[model samples]
Target: MGAEGWRWQDSWIFVSLVIAGGAGRHRRSAATRRPEGIRLTDVLATADHLNRSIPERDDVLGAVRRLAGAGLVTVTDGWFRVTTAGEQLWRSRPSSGMGTTVDTVQKLLNRRCQPGDTDWTLDEDEYGIAVQEYIVRLLPRPRRSPETAQERAEPS
Candidate 1:
């Protein structure tokens, strides 16, 4: 998987959409054989909460478009559902390395975004900051500790 091609936020938003789809209740719609997929609003709301980024509709839509192109999700009207490939993607756990951002995000997602889950009691502001920090840590740049920054500033 060329996950490297995708921005961290885009990948996170895609997972958020998948979780939202799984959590949606199966409502029958006469026009479509499949059950009512998750609403775009709901998915966007979840992504905003998880990433604390409050991404523009276009941003989320772009991610959705990419996922659709990859056959990871199917969209109709304003609803979305995960395809078989999406399920596989979700099940493929990130490599487990202690203290790694990927592992932490994976654990958090599993704990809080399970299918059919409805219990979320986290403070919105705090959770948002937490999500933001987690995403920042996943960036490819070398992490610079505060002490290291201070030492660099203090020339010999």
Candidate 2:
């Protein structure tokens, strides 16, 4: 995909690597100045910890593939490391507003019901429904066309 086509999952995976210290300059041994990268397991664990929920392994792999395809990350011998381009992308992300979706989702998922509220227990289906409701509410509504808005304003 193009540079502007980064998905939230992609940003989250990249950020997780950065947060885990798998990106940027690393302290190197005097003899061998090689950079260190984290393992795939570490990435998954870091992402899970950051989001407070387990991310699907397949989804993480998919994001890695996309990042790799974009030359943002490199995978070698089971180690994943961010490329220079990736570091640049991360550094400039604040101006591009890339992490908002991940932040919003993290906040929503981390929200807990108050102690005095009704029992927070939920079955699998109930949890699914609740999540769907939240997603629907959070998504932006499409704007109506000017003609449609005028027609509605005119009333029956």
Candidate 3:
């Protein structure tokens, strides 16, 4: 393979590593952020807690792992201090990672709803209206069905 091939392979590898890494980074960031009084294990804790309260960056775990790999944390000790750049990034970036439950649930629904259809751009109010309309018209909903008005009008 050429240089391009190597680069493409490396890109894929990076993405794979990121996927494998999970929410580690965000956890580290959170650990670093807590006050001096807070305990690492107490505040920035187990998988269940991570999954429950702090719905941070999609690649958060990877970030934490990277921090560990870079000597930011002693994994065995379960303690980490935020690096300067990480602090900068954490401060500057939007908190889309720690998303709302509603946003997350709606995202799942959006994926299941369509691929080729219109993209999900509706506001919450609009979605509520759309869903209501959809439910009301769920079975045998109106469409520009073939056949004259007489056929539909007559019924079965």
Highest-scoring model, TM-score: 2
Q: Which order, best to worst by TM-score?
A: 2, 1, 3
- Give the Cα lDDT of each candidate: 0.55, 0.55, 0.32
lDDT of 3 at 141: 50
**Local accuracy of candidate 1 as per-residue lDDT tens digits, 1-156:** 223244455466666765566622235232343467775555656666666656654455555555576666676654677776666665565544322433344454344332221122234554455446656655799889999999999969
Candidate 2 residues 74-95, lDDT tens each? 7676566777766665544433
- C-alpha lDDT (0 to 100) for residue 12 of candidate 3: 22
Preferred candidate (TM-score higher): 1 or 2:
2
The alpha-carbon root-mean-square deviation between model 3 and the true structure, to one decimal in Å, is: 20.8
Each prediction's TM-score versus the true structure: 0.50, 0.51, 0.26
Better of 2 and 3 by lDDT: 2
| Native-referenced Cα lDDT, model 1 | 0.55
lDDT against true structure, model 3: 0.32
Q: Higher-TM-score candidate among 2 and 3?
A: 2
Model 2 residue 120 distance off true place after TM-score fit, in angstroms: 41
